[model samples]
Target: MKRFALFALFVLVAAVLTSCGLYNSKMASDPADVETVAVVEDAATEQAEETAEPVVAATEEVVEEAKPAEPQIFEPGSFESPDRCKNCHRDIYNDWKESMHAHAWTEKWYQQDFMMAHHETDGATDLLCGACHAPIAARTGQLPPADGSMFDETAKRGISCDFCHTVTGLDQMYNMGHVSEPGNEKKGPRGDGRSLYHGVKFNENHTKADFCGSCHMVIHPANGTHIIDTWQDWKTNWYGEQNITCQDCHMTPTPGVQETPGRAALLGKWRDNMPYHGFVGASSYVQDAMGNKKQAEMAREYLKSAAEMKLAETVAGDGNLALTVEVHNVGAGHKIPTGTTYIRIMWLEVIVTDATGKVVYSSGLVDEKNHVDPDAVFFRVQFRDADGNLTGKSWRAQGIGYDRRIPAKGMDSETYQIALPAKGEYQVSTRLMYRSFTQATLDEAAERTGEEYPPVESVEMAAAQTRVVF
Candidate 1:
């Protein structure tokens, strides 16, 4: 019985191995026949599958490309109407409306000068005074017509809020070469902001000297002659070295330097300090026009701080007095009376008084005809015509024959030597005077406009007094 059981188990194991394919070689003794059966099965399956399959084709995926960024376009309008800003920012708008920026376009003097330049140049206002007086109008293709009717109420206001806020980038330093990227991006001194309007705000660049340089430095487009390079002058001087921005000095109530704390907008967060928009400098004319006494005082203070005068003398045994007067450009970034160099006048006036208060000698004294003494040492720039003739007309100037421009933080000295009869106690005084225009030019301008031009008043930039008892 045990032998029979063992045999049965062995048989069961052999059957299981055959079914699992382990005993295929032993089961298929006729290999050729087995191969024929496999081939027939594969062929029958292929035919069955081919008959049941559909005739659809496989396709490739299609990717969509992204679109490019669009260029920004500015909306055409006037920001001159301070009433619009008053609706939102009442306090700031009130301050601005009372400031000189508001009257920049409508001022009587500016209108007269602009109209004269326009009338004489035959619609050439776009290249001349419009660069400063009506910057927005010129940029928006509204200028070349000084009549103001060509532009709307806002544009006629000159450098308005929308115009300044819309400035996207600067092409060069000065002379209205700024590029306008008009959009929702309101570039300012603060870069960090969240506004509904699609725009960016940066505080650093806007508060720097470069912002003021856009219009302060004027260069002739045709000749490449530097008409005004105030920005460059400041950059090359101590102001740049000290990291002093134009806004640091001009926009502060203290005149020189101070922190201005305020909010940029009503809904904006409060900043410890923000750049003010007063933009006060040495422009008494505009201050008077706007009836702003505080602004005029600020202008006077700026002029007063612009230079320093010193008198040094070397006496000889033969009663010859050699007086050296040094004038230092201390405050202004550009040449002492920078804009419209032809019209700007800067000169040194020396008065020697005896012990009795009688004037012994006087230089740079204006006569009844409003002519400066020819012998005076004048600190001014002279432009030359094509023929090398000195001409007061800046438009006709092709080259600069004499450029005694007072450099930024630079000192210029003039020596006057004269023989005195008998000097007891002499008081020598030196003064640096600045005027808007020459008498001849003002006379011509008055005659052309048939309006009595305002008298040119000289502001004492700096003065020095010394006592010499020999």
Candidate 2:
């Protein structure tokens, strides 16, 4: 009977594996390949630059057939799928289901970018991108040749339970050096908590911010430009000095909550800290468009907590209204609009009106196309390509020309001078606006997909108004 029971369990496991199209992977065995994280940080490194759009299938012509990417192989471990973990971690699983990480692999934006990279580089860039987008497939030999033709269902799960839990170690702060040994024995933060469903070993790296820094601190693969430096910024700031890890804000209920007491396992009693798994980030527009309402709201909440602004000075002088505004990065652990900051947009909009309601001056006016005015004080980085041309092509970025992004706990004092036609009780309104993508990208994507793209989510961080009396 015992033998029969074991055989039945084996059959069930085989069926699940076959149905999910699981395959053998050897990326874990080769630590070197796994460490070459594919983060294409493109910054405009020129004084004068033009806005360049990335080559996308929706806008650009796909004139090449991509050769399949060579699969990076590693020894497959006894890792259980996310569904199996859901048996005990129902709440955590549900939270992760609606997160951007869950859609990291199959999201339309990512798909467009990945396809563009594949076609541009003739499929050579697949594994680099796949290392973060599809770690399961990239490591399991499921995506050899970097093409998506051979991906299994498990690969579509994005950052899966097995891939995260199986991570055994990391090499450095940047890139994708996460070492995973997937299989029945799952590693975690719990020291003594054991599960009948799987084995568990406490991993100290799980408790550190650098653990999350594996894929967060991105660098240019060829030129070594520091593209995404959120981790590094925090490391050198007050937060890191106080030992405030990334998990404190991102993995907990509060954005910067230090820790919370809870049970690490299903049957265990309330112990110390237990991190949540939503893995939230600043991605409301995409998340809402992708039908994750809860995730979108959470993103909005994060943004609302990110910064605070106030109208510092308002004076009528020299036939003009001179005003000063103060914007402080108060809540976020990193800089506002941190990752993929080149594409991310943040700016200031100021409007001045007379007591009679006549418009005196206006900046940051949204055009009919839903784009911010070009001359507004924008907080964004512009990347340049190898030929010293400005472009949004992150994967091909070789230089950063201009980066106006606000840093952690930082403040920006912006002064605006507006010519007053008639300065009689002038009322000035100021606001700090945030959006995921520029209006141009949205329009291009809409034209290419033929599907009605969701509206550009322009969130207001803060607003204030003061009277300018002459």
Candidate 3:
């Protein structure tokens, strides 16, 4: 009867264990834990040779049950500060610190734009815009107000280190499809690396254009308009079929090549290649105003590299000069000015001077109020509002008015007619110029901040000079 009671007691204990879920399902998913269990069991068997085998086996099984699985994820607020990443990767950290990605949320211009869009939409697009600009705050449910009232200290970091490395995968190409876990297991290009602070895993998505496209492509929530189609431009173009991702251009020593050799971490070992963290793009005006000189220069270099300008055709006849200036999109895979195209400005500035240094004609001059000349051939997306009036505010846009931006590997031959009034050997100079903010928008931004605002910065992207003999 005692033997029968022992068997019944053991059965009851097993039943209770099953009901209480003592065996974790997550353990099976963890290969490291499984390997640990196997090693422990084998070691226990080896020790059992000199002791009671049954007792040793039972203890080993209990030990295995008590061992916890490796953590794969963390709660939203558990992200490490961007400064923490600087402790090891100072170079990358410094580079990223000055980038627009780092300033995406914190930039005053973006904040003003967000507030304006939210106000225009009656708080409808608060989350839609914030999802990309302030992703951490948006993911944590602090972005509905879009006034940045609910954001925490960490969320204000914008696209900080932890938020990016924690991204496991992407779901789609639009509307914040980046799925991040926000934990110590930082996914990057390094897989064999073992860090003192966090687990390292290789995530190839970091090197893909699709990943960048996931956030870079923005669509309007109200009218279902493709507000930002930078990614689509690249994906459907020659570059995408060639497998040249966005990382190849924005993160490389030379745009479109992917072999940047350096150490990604402070491991005292060299990696085959390391991508730059500057995230360089065509944001010279904005980056300069943000007090990031190096990044501004980098952005300037990128813009300069994006286009090439030359006099495709020139005519000097009948006391008049007609020139066809060819502007080619040589470097960029998408349109010249891709994101926030309405607010951004890209135009052709042409000037004709006589041999005696007298200005005969000039186009694309900035007015006293910092506005570009209305007659300049500006490459920008135009929009119409609900009330059928032209508007630059994207949230109020009902339809596209016109898209004059140059496509990738495309050319825009602009014909300028100038009257050769007493001209002796007229010299023509043409440049493609770009600026992020216009005077009207900057005025509103200054009014909102109640501080001294930066003057409108118009960067010359490309230049061409030729002398037309009349």
- Candidate with maximal lDDT: 3
How close to the true structure is residue 283 of candidate 3, measured as C-alpha lDDT?
81
Better of 1 and 3 by lDDT: 3
Tens-place lDDT digits, model 3, residues 107-199: 888886677555544555565677678777766656656677877887788888888898888766665667777767999865777789888
lDDT computed for candidate 1: 0.60
> Highest TM-score: which candidate?
2
Mind giving the per-residue lDDT tens digits that candidate 1 earns over 1-470? Answer: 00112223223322332243322343234332121212211111222223321211101010011111111222246233545555655556656665667677877766766664444344443345565677666655565456877776777676767667666566555555455654456666667866664465774556678877867765443343455556766776788888787878877755577787777667767777766566777676557645788777777788888899888897788878899999898877566666655556678899988888888888888878766665566655555444444444444445554556577777878788866668588889889987665665556656656767656667788999887765
Q: Considering summed lDDT, which 10 consecutive residues are worst modelled in model 1?
A: 58-67
The TM-scores, one per candidate, come to: 0.76, 0.82, 0.80
Ranking by TM-score: 2, 3, 1
* Model 2 RMSD, rounded to 1 decimal: 11.5
**CA lDDT, candidate 2, residue 119:** 54
Q: Give the residue spans of candidate 3 off by over 4 A.
A: 1-76, 253-258, 314-317
* Residue pairs with backbone atoms closer than 3 Å in model 1 (clashes): 185-199, 188-202, 189-202, 189-203, 190-202, 190-203, 191-201, 191-202, 191-203
